[model samples]
Target: MKNTTLYKKFFVAINGSNSEQRPLSIALSGGVDSVVLLHLCYTLREQMPGWVIEAIYIDHGLSVDSDSWRAFCQRLCESLSIDFKTASVEVKAKARHSLEAQARDARYAALDSLAMANSMIVLGQHGDDQLETFLLRLKRGSGLDGLASMRAQRILDSGRVCIRPLLNASREDIEAFARMFAIEHIEDHSNKDDRFDRNFLRNQVIPLFKSRFNGFLQSVLRSIELLQQQQSLIEELTLQDLQTCCSEQGQLDLQRLGALSQLRQANVVRSWLASFNEKMPSKVQLEQLLHQALTSKQDAQINIVMGKGCVKKHRGFLYFVIAQDPPQPCVDVALAPITLNDGRALIVEHGVGVRAPNNNERISVQFGLLSSKIRPRNKPGRNAVKHWLKEAGVPSWQRAHVPLIFYDEQLVQIVGYYFEHSMYVPQQGVRWEVVDGE
Candidate 1:
């Protein structure tokens, strides 16, 4: 509870983090927790030799005082001689998502863009925050991973490392440290509103719980630690199961996955989705996915949509298909990169590809020409583009997006799939490739 003890605890946590070599970007919200963290890190700057401590404030533009909050954080950083930066983001609400969720997503996205590459992001979440998150997840019927709650240090899917030095520090200790240093911070008016679940818990539920049980927080913390250990073991086993059932193309082999128990099957599905950085489906949705995947007819087409993409089953393999806009037909062709409308790039390069276009020929790129025929090099004869794509195991929904390169009116190349047999050259020649857009 003493200021010195609090400082020592934070120092030990940060010093042992192994992020001393990297710059630290504090997610400063101009609140008590963050202000205290900033003060501690800045005061101990002499001890952390390699750390370049800075503060980044993300303005969600939701509150009228958002700019004032940013200015406050900037001034605080200036007083401490710490670098300060701000990013303003528009929080757009989406279906089946709360405003808090949207704002949180926007805030993190702004942080990711504003922070330096490979910089460690420092968040000022305390023990009370962790307990609130645990309760919220529990209310939503979260599993082991959710119950494990926040990690002191976690590497995000974007490969950015985030650390919480105050995770184990109690709110009381943080407030005491602030009072001891006479630290200044702004109180967000939204914190007083009980309509939000977290705010309600922090303002009402937690206080009552603490009053009734002095050691409740400590017991919950121990439970979370134990849950984290169990979740880590589960993740290890899930990876092994994934390796056995997932294909090189990132598709899960239904037969292999079905061999596992129903619970194991669900675990594998969840892990597979996570590997792709896709959002996890609800319990009902996940159950439906498994049922359709295992019981559907062999020739049945399964297309279930979730989180920026749809999942499809093809030949017993479950594939995650990112939603792409319809490809627009292009009339020009050159030995350069052509940006496609469907978030893909058509690159034409000289290699063991198709022969170069003649001076009299007009080259162009087209899409949705599945009815057209093209003779692939080394193949027996010309076949419909649709049939070629089928033989190549291209999903039906994606066939329309495949770029078709033509010399004048003749089909010469299928961009990525194959080159026209007549125009193909085994030696040095121009070839085409399709890649994800930047």
Candidate 2:
């Protein structure tokens, strides 16, 4: 109850010496932990005049009392004369993850959208939440990154840094503070539902461990810190390896990646995918990907579906391409610019000092052109589109999406790859080019 000094010191340490200069946004869930957090920050605001404190409540709309929680949060914020905002998000479960995860995702997304660039967003995850996360991830067979558990501070994908100032504080600390201050907070009945893994861990497993081991939570915290240190070293090594294995287009060099130890390979791939904001592949999926990359023949094609995208290997490189719905077949290309389904546009340029297509010639843009015998400019022999794409180092998975330009059914040019020489007259007229649309 008299731990206000501890709360002040923790917040000051996490926020650094310039804590008073920047804006602080507290994520208020109308729970005891967050209510305590908000109260502490509100009190701190008086001592630090430069601090602009506000609160945000995210309503997932999954519970009947969500609206009541929002109103309670708003009233609390109003009583403290603090700015407040609310966001409603839909939580839908996906095949690969759980509803709890989906809801968390939605909650964070809403927070991210509401946060300003470079601002610090504070969350109410205390030691208990950290322990629960560690246990859950351990059960799921997570790697070192997962085992490291929640960080006290981390930068989110939205560029806002999230700081858990209460990470070192126990749930009991928060409850005591709330009770001492007579803080009013909403209670979510779902927290006690053992159907959720985290709830089960919190209500059952954690209690059993606490009863059996006098300082089990502290031991787990120490282990998490050690894992975090190890994970940091791995990340440093991954950065170095990425510099050597990543291409100009951000594709991973399969040859370079294959040369690494299996563990290193997985690390590099994980780092590569993380750069693209893609989800980390499961352990089994990652091993399968590495095996295929290392053992596949030079001519062998590889494609593995990932979250909302796929990993592709062609020639000696691996690339991640987002999944797109199939485009309608063969959209005609007129003299004017025409946009394709994939947001790339084909434009006909005339009188630009190159040979233009003949007046009788017709041009159309299409996908999956499989015909051969189309020779690229300055190349000796005709080759199939597949062979040409392969020779050009295009991944097989991407070939189907490449726009092929045809002159009356004769494949004249591959939009981004090759141009057929016969279609152009030297030192005269018009041409066509494909460009990415905004």
Candidate 3:
């Protein structure tokens, strides 16, 4: 591509729908691709007047030359009078997960924290990187969603926008732009190690493919676009299926879900997990989940480990409960919202539910009192809290999270489930609402 054409592409990407006037944070690695991207943004600065342009280098600290690369990026940014920042991340590798993936997750998290909100995080990934990603997913037996590859623009779960202006440009196009402008860049020595799948592809597999078929990359790009379109249709169908099978509390109704074909059932589950931003389960894990959901005994407890949470079944419904810190042992209850250490809050409102505590009474909320007994609104007598939880169909693992409201030393309310029979009022009462923290 010509210099002017490349500039126009960057301009259009930054000026795309719902993206105008947002600051740009370029992911600089002191490599040709990113260096060229920074140069383009710097040259096009006049076109995007009043927009902030900066470069951020994330040091994974895995390579011996990591410090030098950060220095290089800092100098380059200074030469162009752009803001420069660096962040170091610890890549915590887990079993069955690749180091690359761990580093990527850490890098993205750091960027999310350091970048300005409502701004764009520009990446320097090109068409060659897209081809490598498609092949990598194919090697892992990924379905259509994975094979669809990267997009020019996407919004992260954190609501920050990311754009890849170089996604459509070929590697040769970027190199030519760099050479024509005599731009200097550094290379990471780790790229020479074929132990990495991407390195192996770039050095051995892709060159042969390019030589064998002159338009191989273009053909793959076209296929990716078609797959993306097909994936979009599937997403729409999954959403429609979800409406029938998913409850307002984000629980999946097994009866409704099982009515669909096995393929549709899996599709709905994947979409359901995606709605909660949960990592997609592997094929084997997904099959096991479906099997347990369909054939397990009605009273049998079901708990499947997912990313940071567990999938549990209770009363014919499946819920994804993330692990969270337990709430404080006790908290004073008042008119203002009471925020818990965990991502939860209780808003006590004046409504028809439980009777307001008397002026002399000390109102507080407590957790984990399974042995305590209380009489539900119309119940004959007090029953153990554990029995009340079981009767209410609360999952065994989640029974401890139920917030108990105390009037002095007596249990008067189960925040979300019921009110004490003696404390219940028909006219004026305090109703409690639970607000989930993100």
Candidate 4:
């Protein structure tokens, strides 16, 4: 390769890029690191075989020179024989999204929109950059997981993998390579402004520490590597535990979780929640979640509304789900219909499905149907099953998620509970099945 990275290891790791079915897309800020990565990928295009390189420039439109940066990137890509792309994105600094977060999100969103399925987006993050991130997390008083920071293979929301090829390379190496190649990288004046935390670390804070203690950078980086190793092990254990404790509908076991060490709980919760990719619960919210979920009365209804959804406890199962009411599965119930597709038919209600095997014993789960004409008697049938369960102590908040079968305008069966005597399967072989409810 005409232009290789300072360390051949990063290129090999990136060239391996793990998933080649996902092609390569580069974030070209026209900085030394990004430009070097773009050049390296372009030079090794033949070696990569089927790899496709797209240089994407995200102009935040925060400055007057932003347009010039885009043009520079386009020209640079043209010279390098790489496809060029540019996205004009708005960076919001509202209270909800801090400036740093907003810019990063917007940039990635733009990349995701442009990337093909399972494609990989390569970042210019090298060893020094990773060290800075680790230090930032350390300053926040986070544990090992936080210090682990970025990984080599993290899936993005767009279903693309964000791969950092230069993760183990340093700034000095990248700058040297850029100058050697006469690569024309834009020098953003903001880098000199020192208003950014990263810039402060690079310019002032880091130099002071370096003067006081030689090799401080490498020492701190070594500590981060150790933390990364520990964090990876914790994640592996947490996942194994999750698989063992997961409920049928992806619910977690609070008691099982509480039994683990407190530090392990944080690791488990973060890994578990991230598995769903939901807006994560904060540290305080996570603590509260553990407390209420494990310690609250077994039957007590615990509903936590945070981020993009809610976590609820129902019938000894823990649910982390979308905050919105999912439309009832569009299904109509039929009496004496035992099975569908070689599987038991489900009775559908508000937001749930009840599957009662025709020949199986009367299980612990209750069931029901909705019918204006059918009035099933409970132990003491009076009003409707709806009214009966509500009065019998089903919490109002929990009612919405419970399966309540409706026959037309009337409520007949409630799955898992009891069938309406009027609408029960008339014969021994007769069975009622739940389907999607409108």
Candidate 5:
């Protein structure tokens, strides 16, 4: 390949200096594929003036060789006169997904951070990958959206646009380019381990088919392209349909939703939250969400958490919630200070606090209290909440969703949604407010 032409194509795919004043950060994994990507990107500056480029490598810390691979990548970047960075990630099994998924998630999380405040990150996913992903999705019986496979240029969920310059290029082409440039690359021994599904498909399935069919990879690529076009149409319709069917309460309009075939309903939900490559919900979770949403009561409020995010249904439309178990659970998630030493009056809601017992009387509180100057009535009217909600006609199940403040072992307040006047904060003593959303 002509270096200048390759550079021009890659540079333009990044949208160039004219389209974006921002620089481009390329993710280099030290593999042959990414090494070629780095070389191609390095040629960009010569092809287009003012095209800034940076390279980032995330050491996932999985293999003992991770450190050496990173060091090699750093040295390669240094020799090429490109700025390089090393980012480390810890991919613990934090979700109800595969270890591979978690590691990929964590690796990207690190890369996204490495991309810095503003700038797009480039990845090296060639045509071979696009074909394998298509087959994988097909084997799983996924819809057109999944069969479509990866795109060349798509804006990631992080609000950053990721461009794959080599999407149309074959793996053989990349290796040829690498060998031509005499570029050194690391071979991950793990790729030989067929334990991974993708590896198995590449080594076993694809080879047999390739031997039988001269251009199977090209055929698969073309098939995926066709599926992608059809998926584009479906995605367009699904987004528009969701807008009309989802209400302000973040719940779906069952009346409108029920009008569609069961398959269409599923498509609408999946497409609303996804496009060509937005991570689709798992089959089990998708089925559960569809069933619960379709079969539940008209006034039901539903919340299902999966992965790093969650889906909530309130009123008649679905809402996305981003809150999670805090990064430092002990420090940030646990806001209460446990308990105060001695008779120090503990502010009931601050996780933990302490203060001396006061003899003062006359308390002013909103939670409905008697002349008895208790700072907080101990769990009063908690049982009455179900009755109050019943009186107010709130369902039996929803009372739990409402935030209820607790004083140590006792329920002190049922915030915004409800408050039992019987349990009021006391006057002429330490003050405490009902806890709400954190």
Candidate 6:
């Protein structure tokens, strides 16, 4: 196979003619697809003098042959005079996720950590991979976002752009290129394991389709392109709706979200979740979420856990809370300022009408004092800590995490809400205030 078209497409994808300089890192897996991609990119480095070419091999440690694959990648990179790096990652397959998915996640995480800012990380996924992803998502009843499959270019979490320059090329094209160039590559034995859904599709389903229908891959690609366009439109509309539905502190206004159509509501919710880089909910989970949002009573508390986080509805707003360990108990407050487990600091400052702790008084910071009462600086009467938090517009999810300054058994002040004015006279004195650290 001729390399002219592939080289041109790769060059354009990396913006080879651009005057700005940025490094390009190829994700090399010692596979034919990646080897051909690396070779093509290496051949173009002379034309794009501003670009730095490098290769990264991520060893998931799932197989005994991983070391040999890493060595192959290193030797290939050395032969091409390109910088080589290897990251060893542990693949922890949870009960809910497959080993393949876990390995992919670990590999991408390693690659993201190895990538630099403003660099382009090249992947070797081809047209067949895209088709498999689409079919898998379809079988799982995915929405437009999943059905659209992978994109040619996407911004990663490390501020690096991931580009699949070979997305339009087929696996046969890659294999032919590898043979024509005499590129040395290794085959992962796991690829032949049909127990994995993707492998099963590649070995059994896809071949059956190819045998029965001419140009089936091309037809699938055309459908994917159309679905991608439709998905893009939905995303644009969701962004516009999200502006109206977003509330303070990155929460979503449930009332505003409810005003939209059901499909629009799901789109906005998905868009909101993506803003925080949260994993997308499954079809059933999403349906349940929409049902809860649309039908649940206004006064009822709603909390639904999904992935590593949860969707919670409180006070007419929706919040995504990442599952985290309980906040550690606050430490004893001495004369110096102390920081809390939630990144808030307890500071002692000298001010008028401030109450200074006595020598015998036990000074400390505490959280979740629901029954505690405090007389705010300007308020008329003592109010419950929970009520004050609600009046101050603090969400229910964050109320328990609010740091409270206590002198012995009495709640002296609530951080960011009330400081007891009557605790001390108007003189040069010391008071405690909680400062936001994040």
- Cα RMSD for candidates in order: 3.6, 3.5, 3.4, 6.6, 8.1, 3.2
TM-score of each: 0.85, 0.85, 0.86, 0.80, 0.70, 0.87
Per-residue C-alpha lDDT of model 1 across residues 242-316, encoded as one tens digit per residue:
999998878999999999999899999999998878899989999999999999986679999998788898878
Show where candidate 2 strays beyond 4 Å.
1-3, 17-20, 93-96, 116-118, 194-196, 204-216, 325-341, 345-354, 358-367, 372-387, 400-412, 436-438
lDDT tens digits, residue span 119-202, model 3 = 688899989999999999999888899999898777887888788887777898788888888999998778899999999999
The digit string of per-residue lDDT tens for model 2 on 1-438 reads 324754765566556723545677889999998899898888777755667888999998899998999999999999999999999998876796778778887888888888655567888888889999998998978888999999888887766778888877788778878887798898989999998888899999999998999988878888998999999998999999999999888989888888888888989999998888888888889899999888989767788988768888777788888877545555445668777777877677665323555678776777786664587778888888999987887766677877777778787777667777666455555566778879
Which should have the higher lDDT, number 5 or number 6?
6
Best by lDDT: 1
Deviation in Å, model 6, residue 296 alpha carbon: 3.4
- Candidate 6 displacement at residue 288 in angstroms: 2.7
Candidate 1 stretches greater than 4 Å from native: 1-3, 92-95, 325-365, 374-383, 403-408, 412-438
What's the lDDT for residue 377 in model 3? 83
Give a tens-digit lDDT track for model 4, residues 1-438. 354546475567775765444567888998888988888877667666677778889988788999888888999888778888888999867975668778888888998887656568888888778877887887888766677887766777656678888776767778888888787788888878788888888778777877899877678767777877887787788888777667766877777776788877776777777877877677888899888887889788888886777788866667876654422432443443323332335532332222333332232222332222234444545455556566555544545444545544434455555455655543442223446433
Better of 1 and 3 by TM-score: 3
The residue-by-residue lDDT of candidate 6 on 1-438, one tens digit each, is 224666666667666423365677889999998999898878777764556878999988888998988998989898889999899998786897778788887878888888766667889998999999999999998877789999988776766677888777778777877777787899989899999889999999999998999999989999999999998887888899999999768888988988998888988988898888888887678899989976888766789887668888877888899855435666565878886676767777776545787888887777777788888788889889998888887878788887777888878777667777577556777666768898
lDDT of 5 by residue, 1-438 (tens): 444444455556656432755777889999998998888877766555687888999988888999889899999989978889888888786566778778877877787877866877888988888877887888889776767888877665687777787777778778877777788999999988898889998889888988899988888878888888898888777777877777664546767887888777888877655532335787788899888877888678777875556666655455566553211111111233322122122233422222312333222222222121223233343345445544555433344443334333334344444433444434432223333323
- Local error of candidate 3 at residue 308 (angstroms): 1.0
Least well predicted 10-residue stretch by lDDT in candidate 3: 1-10
- For model 4, state the Cα shift of residue 131 in Å: 2.0
- Report how far off residue 56 is in candidate 6 (Å): 1.8
The deviation in Å at residue 57 for candidate 5 is 1.1
Off by over 4 Å in 3: 1-5, 17-19, 92-94, 324-326, 331-365, 375-377, 405-438
TM-score of 6: 0.87
lDDT of 1: 0.87
